[model samples]
Target: MKRVLFLFLLIGFISKAQVKPTIQKDDIVRIETTLASDKMEGRQIFTTGVDSASAFIEKEFSKVGLTYYKGLKNYRQEFVVRNASANNVIGILPGKSKPNEYVVFSSHYDHLGKEENGKDKVYNGANDDASGTTAVIALANYFKELNNNERTIIFVCFTGEEEGGFGSKFFSESINPDDVIAMFNIEMIGTESKWHKNSAYITGFEKSNFGTILQNNLKGSKFRFYEDPYLEENLFYRSDNATLAAYGVPAHTISTSKMDSEPNYHQLSDEVSTLDFDNMTEIIKAIAISSESIVNGKDTPTRVQKIR
Candidate 1:
């Protein structure tokens, strides 16, 4: 009886240990507040907004104690695509054991710049991706606090997602694809989903085993993960994830976008006021937990098969 009781205690301890880090609500609020602030000008590509967003990310990286990729002096991974000056804000949270293999968490910070009317100038894409951007920042902080991952976690704030996914495209080519284990591209998760109130879907769900792994990891949680319903939207190829997915990585976008009927998507009214803070916090937590397996090198999501 004593031996059985000891075994039970050990299992309980392991279960508690597997629980992922929690992203603070205040942290999420501050990140979103700063990213969506008017001074950033909606983070438009090739504009002052983009520059301001980059600065914010750089500061956060420094604050989180993340290191620049080894052998590099700076955190900025500068690159260009299509004559447009773009960059990927790269920072590394080295693994405790396997410091080379990487699990990349990314979100594009760029949005539609100024509107044609020239009067209502701000195209504040709060939900389109600021939600995702803020979440990435929060995740970095959470992991930093945990301070224990077996696989390097690469946090990237991508630019030019709205302009042809050029930022990620450039980044995918720059890195050794073999070293990258998976890519979790957060996008448009500010709103509630059509399924469960706190549910979200992964783009290109059928193309890779990533979705299955994430869903199984999140079992018993209120959140439910599903295939992107707007497949007709060709959403798999629509976001930054597409760039890495094209390279045969298990790259997928996590989102709550109801593209077929979203009233605020890319519109002037897509402001921060419409977001559900509590729900957003829950979603962030869910992502944190779902990714715990990957972060620890305990589970390797299946790679995407090359599409002909």
Candidate 2:
């Protein structure tokens, strides 16, 4: 009887030690709402709205205990594109072993600021990219708490994606492409994919084995990551991932928006209410889990063929 009682106590202790994660649906909703609100003025580059968005991202990074990247005093990495000044908010969670290698999570925070002729002037980009930005924060917090990564994880929220991927283009020039193991660029995950339930898509899925690795990690799970359905649209080159992919980095964008049917794309009607927070949470969690092998340095995805 004493042995049985001790066994029960041991199980109880183990369960207690496994604390629940803080990245909940409510947290996602709150962050998305704030980032996509009218108060942000659509987060356009060179606008006050974009500045406010960057400041909020910095605060969120600080709250989650993510350290600023090396050679920087703060989270904001400011750069210039033509005459316009832009910043990418970056934070780092150093690895337990292979600190020199990097696995990056990126999302652009900028959107079309506002429209002149529309009756609804504010272009709140709730689904366009606020959802992606929220995932970056959520993943950062999740990884920080778990503390199990083997390769350094960099979380970056870029500013000039709306203006022809300028932010990522500038950022790609700053880092040595060889050190970057992979980049998962999250975009427009606020809605369900054309697959409609429990699935998302990856652009440029055939360029490398990146999607295969992610799907392999999610074996036996309901959540699925598939190839982009809108191949004819040439989505692979459209988003922030293109810059690094051009340099042979295994970078791709994950998204749930149906390109042909997504009604809210670049419209004034894209608000927080239109998003499905539960689905968003599931996608973010799946990203965290699917990235485990890469983060641990156990799986190295094949590099993309550099485009001329």
Model number with the top lDDT = 2
Winning model by TM-score: 2
What is the Å distance of residue 218 in model 1 from its true position? 1.4
TM-score per candidate, in order? 0.90, 0.95
Which residue pairs collide in model 2, if any? none
| Candidate 1 overall lDDT versus native | 0.86
lDDT of 2 by residue, 60-162 (tens): 9999999988789999888888787889999999989999999999999999999777678888999989999999999999999888899999999988888
Task: Report, for every candidate in turn, its global Cα lDDT versus the true structure.
Answer: 0.86, 0.93
The clash count of every prediction, one per candidate, is 0, 0
Candidate 1 lDDT, tens digit per residue, 9-66? 9999998785656777788878887888778887888888889988998899899988
